[model samples]
Target: MTESRPHALFCFGTLLDPRVQTALFGRTVPTEAATLAGHATRPLAVAGDSVTAAGGRDVRPTLARKLGATVEGGVLRLSDRELAAADDHEIDDHVRRRVTLASGETAWAHLDARPLRAAARIVIVGDSIAYGRCDPEGGWAGQFATAHIAADEHAHRVFNLAVPGSTLADVGEQTPALLPPRHPDTIVVAAGINDSAVPLAASDTGIDGLRDITGPLDALLATARRHHARLVVLGPLWLDESCTGDFEGLRFTAARALELRAALRTWCAEHHVDHLDLWEPLRDRPELFVDGLHPGTEGHKELYRYLSAHHC
Candidate 1:
C-alpha cells in the first residue's frame, strides 16, 4: 500500500471554535495558524448557523472566493476520519479542495460548492473499463455523456474521468485533482481488473495486492463521498479463459477474475455501498470480448444497458 497522505484542513469559521470542534470531532483539535489566499470573510447567507457559536451567541461567519483577498485561519491536524467528520459537520455542501497555505503547507480548504440542483452531474472514475477503450461509443459512461447531446441537449452532465491502464491506487491518487469545483451528484467507480492482472509470461492463482484493493477503493471514493455524491460500483469483469493469455502484457484468467470480483463484492457489502455485479451474467459471453481484458463494441452496448438500467 502507498504511504498515507497527510491531510490538513484550513478553518476560517465556526470550525475554529473549540466547543464546535469538540462537538464534531469528540475532542479539541490541534492546529497551526495559517492564511489562505484569494478568499475573504463574508456574512453567511445560510438560513441559520449550523452550529451555535461561543457564549450562546448566534453570530456566524463564512468565506467566499475573492481576488487579491486573504483570510486568516488555522490549519487543523486531523486523521482521515476526523477530516471526514468535519466535512459531515459542514453539511457536505462545501467543496473541500487542496490548497497551498501562505506558509506553503498543502492543506484542504472548504470552498464555494456551486451545487447544480437542476441537472444531474455524474463522474465516472476507473480504469480501461470506465474509459470505454475498445468501444466506438466510448464505453458505458461515454454513451451516457453523448447519447442525447448530439442534437437535443440532455440535462445529464457526465464527466468521464477514467484513465487507461490505471489501478484503483493510481486513480485514487489522481481523482481528487480531476474533480471540478462544482460537486457531482453521482460518482461511479469501475475498477478491479488491473489489480488482478498477472504477467503473460507466468501464471498465478493468487492476487498480490489484496490490501491495496479495498484501501485504494476507499481512497478512490473519499473525495466524492465528502462532496456527497451517490456511489455506484461496477465489479471486476469476468474473464474468458479460452482467450485469457497474452494480452496487454498480462495473462488474465477466469479464476483470477472470480477471485478479484469476490474481493470487491465483499468489500462493497461490508461498506454498504451499492455494487453491481457483472461477473455472472457476462461470464458466459466471451463473444463480446475482443481480448480477455476489454469488451468489443456490442459488448460496450451491453455494458451501457446494464449500467443505465441499474444505476441509482
Candidate 2:
C-alpha cells in the first residue's frame, strides 16, 4: 500500500460552501480562516437589486487575481483521497495553483484560469456520444478539455457541437454555421451512426447502407480540410446487450454499426485523417453505457482517457 500524503488547499469559491465540502469529502475537514493577497472577489451577477434580479442571471461569486488586493477565504487540510475527490469535482474552467495565505503559509487553490486560452481551439461535432447524453456535465467534451488543462501547462478550449438524435443532414446544416470564423486547431466528426441507424419516420430517412453516406461524410471532411483544421473521425460505439432487441424502432443491429465503422475507417484512411474506432475500445465495457445506448458518466470518463492517450 502507498502512503497517504497530507495536502492543503485554499478555497474561495463553491468549495468554500460547507454543503459542497460535505458532498465532496463526506465530512468537512477542519478549516482555518485565511486570506489571500493579490486577489479580489467579484460578484458575477449583473447590476441588479437582490429582489429585482432577472431570471437566468449569474449570481455566483468569482475570484480574480488583482495587484494589491486581498481575498478572505478558508484553508482546508485534506487527505490524499479528499484531494483526489476535490480535483475530480472541479470542472475544466479551473486549475490548481500555489498561493500564500494570510498566515504566511503556502497552499494549493483552484483558480479560474481557463479564460486564459493561450492554446489551440478544438471542436467536436457529432451525435449523442459527442453531445454527452445521460451525463450531467458536458460529458466527454468536458473531460477532454479538463484533462488537457490539467495535463499540459498550455491547453485549448473544446467546443461540443453535437446534438442528440441528429443526423448527417443535421451535421451538414449546423456545423458550417457553428464553427468559428477562424480555423480551429482540431475538428472531430463522430456522426454517421444516427444517419445510418435512425428510422425513416422518426427524424430522418437514414441511409440503407454505407455507400449512401460516403458522399456527405466526404463533403464534411472536405469542408474541414478547407478550413485547415486537423480532422479526427470517430466511429460509432456498440450498444449494451439490453438493446440487442430492436432499438428506436429501426432495429439498430451490430451489422449496421460494423458497416458504418468500416466505411468510416476507409474514408479516414483515404482522407489522411485520424480515426478512432469507438466500438473496439468500448465493446467490453457495457456498464459504461446507460440505457444500452448512451454513455454514462463513467463511459464519458473512459472516452476522455482514450482520447487523451491516443488523440489529444
Candidate 3:
C-alpha cells in the first residue's frame, strides 16, 4: 500500500476553487474547508492588484458594527510537490509562510508583504474599493494577502479592516478598536474618496472629516512607532469623470478625486509615512475599471502586477 503524504495545506485564496485544487494537487490527497478564529477574511487592494486578507480583525457588520466579515475558502492536504507548485503559482503576487492555527498548531499560508517590512504587523483601512467592492473572487485585499505571503516569507502578518461605504472618519474611529492591543509594525491608510464624497458638514470641528480620518491614522502611526512599526499611506486611484457605475450620480468629480489624492500625499509626507501612488498606472487604463472606481478581475491582476513591481 502506498503511504499518504504527511502535509496539511491551508488555502484562503483563489486556490479555494475545486478545479484549481484538482489541477494542482491531482487526486492524491484529501481536502477540507477550515476556518481559523480571531481571523476574518476580506478583499484588499495592493499597489494595483487584489488579494485576500486573513488572520486579522473580523470586519463583518454583525460582529461589531464595523466592516467585519469572514472571507471563506478551502484547505487542502497534499504532497510537498503540490505545495511547491502552489507556491510557484502564487509567487507572482504572494509568498508562502508559516502561521499558527487557532488550535495552537502551525501550518503554511501565503502572505503579501510587498511594501511591508519584515516581522511587521501592517494594517490597511479603507472603503469599498479597499474593502473590495466589485471583485467577483473577492478583491485586491484578498489578492494582496495571498501574494504578500507568497512573495515575502518573512513578514509577520498583514491585517485588513476595510469597510464598504466606510469613510475616513469611520476608519479613524473603528480601526484602532479592531487592532491588537499592542502597536502594529505598520499601518496603511487608504481612505478619502468616501470622505470627499459627503464632504464634512461646515459646523463640524475638532478635526474636519478629512482630518478626522488623518487623526486616527496619525494615532495609529504613533502607536506603531511606539511599537517600532513602519507606517505606509496609500493615495487614491484615478477617477475619470466621464465613467460611472455603482457610485455614479453620487457626486464624486475628477477634480475632487485629484484633490483627495493630493491631500493624502501631503498628509503622508507630513506624517513621514511611506506613500504609494496608484493613480498613474490606472489613469490611462479605463478598461481596468468595472465602473469608475471598482476593478474587474483583469484590473485586479494588473493591480497585483503594479504593486509587485513597485512596492514588493
Candidate 4:
C-alpha cells in the first residue's frame, strides 16, 4: 500500500526481535500491532538447533492459509534498503507475499513454502580485529562463515556485528541488544587490545590505574549465559615494538596483553567457554601484522585456517 509504512511487512517470527532488526536492517523500524486473517502459523520441527521456540523448544514456522484463522503480529515500516535487508535475511528459508491485513491494508509477509527448517545461526561480536580491519575479505570470522560451519546443505547463517575499537565494557553494553530472544547457536568474539591500552593511556579508576578485564569479561559471560549462546572468544593478538610505545596516544604493553589473555584463559576454563589462542603462534610472525596492531590480509587468511581447523 502507498499509505503509511509504504513498505509494510508483517513480522510473526524472528524478525520481531529488535536485535534481529538491528542486525538485518541496521536499525529498528517502527512497528504497530497488526493481524493477518485467513492464515495461521504452524510449527514444524527444525533440523539442527536453528530456531528456538517458546519454553526452550525448537520450531520453524509456516504461515499458511487457513479459513477463519488469524496470525497476530506487528507491521513494520521498511524503507527500500531495509526491505531489501529483510528479504536478504530470510532469503534461504522465506518468501515474501502481498497479503491483506486485518486493518484492510496490503502488506508483505514472510512465509515458507515448505517451512521445514532454518539455518543454524552464528553471531560474532568484538572489535577491530574481529571486524577484519585491514583485511579485504572482512576477517577470520567472515572467512569461516563463507567456508560453512557444516559440510551439509543446512549451513548456518552468520552475522558479524563487531565494531572497531570496542573494549570489553563497550561490548558488554552492546551484547544484550545484539542477541535475540532466541539465542544463537554460537557467539564469537575478538577484542581486548583497546581495553588494555585505555587505562595506561588515560584513566584514574582509583585502583592500580591499569585496566582490569576480568570484571567486564565476567559481566559479558553472564549476559551470554542469559541468552544461552555457545561463546567462542578469540584470544589476544601479539603486538611488536610498534605498539609498545604509543600509537594513538594510547600506550600498549606486552605485559598488559599477556595479563588480559591469561585472565581470559582462566575465565574460559572456569566457565567452560571456548577460547582460541593465537598469541604464541602469531607472536614471532611479525610479518602477519598490518599496522602492528591489526592483522593483514595474509594474517586474516591464516586466522581463517586456524578457526576452520579448531572451531568453525
How badly does each model clash, as a count of residue pairs?
0, 0, 39, 0
**CA lDDT of 264 in candidate 1?**
82
Per-residue CA lDDT of model 4 for 97-175, tens digit only, reads 4567888776777765221122245677888888888988887867776765444435346788889888877787887
In the order shown, the candidates' Cα RMSDs to the true structure are 9.7, 17.1, 16.6, 15.9
Q: Please tell me which model should have the higher lDDT, number 1 or number 4.
A: 4
lDDT of all predictions: 0.68, 0.67, 0.60, 0.69
lDDT of 3 at 248: 39
> Best candidate, TM-score-wise?
1
Model 1 pairs whose backbones collide: none
**Lowest-scoring 10 consecutive residues by lDDT in candidate 4?**
112-121
Candidate 2 residue lDDT tens string, 1-312: 876777889886667678778988898777788988756666544343332243345454556544456888888888888988887766544456455666767677765433222125667788887888889877877777676556553434567778887776667667877775634645678763675564636554654545566676777766665543445677688766556566666656667777788878887667545667778667877788777777899888887777666544
Q: Considering only N, C-alpha and C atoms within 3 Å, which residue pairs clash in candidate 4?
A: none
Give TM per candidate. 0.57, 0.56, 0.55, 0.57
In candidate 4, stretches whose alpha carbon ends up further than 4 angstroms from where it belongs are 1-119, 149-155, 181-183, 198-210
User: Which regions in candidate 1 have their CA more than 4 angstroms from the true location?
Assistant: 1-119, 147-155, 200-207
At residue 269, candidate 2 shows an lDDT of 69
TM-score of 2: 0.56
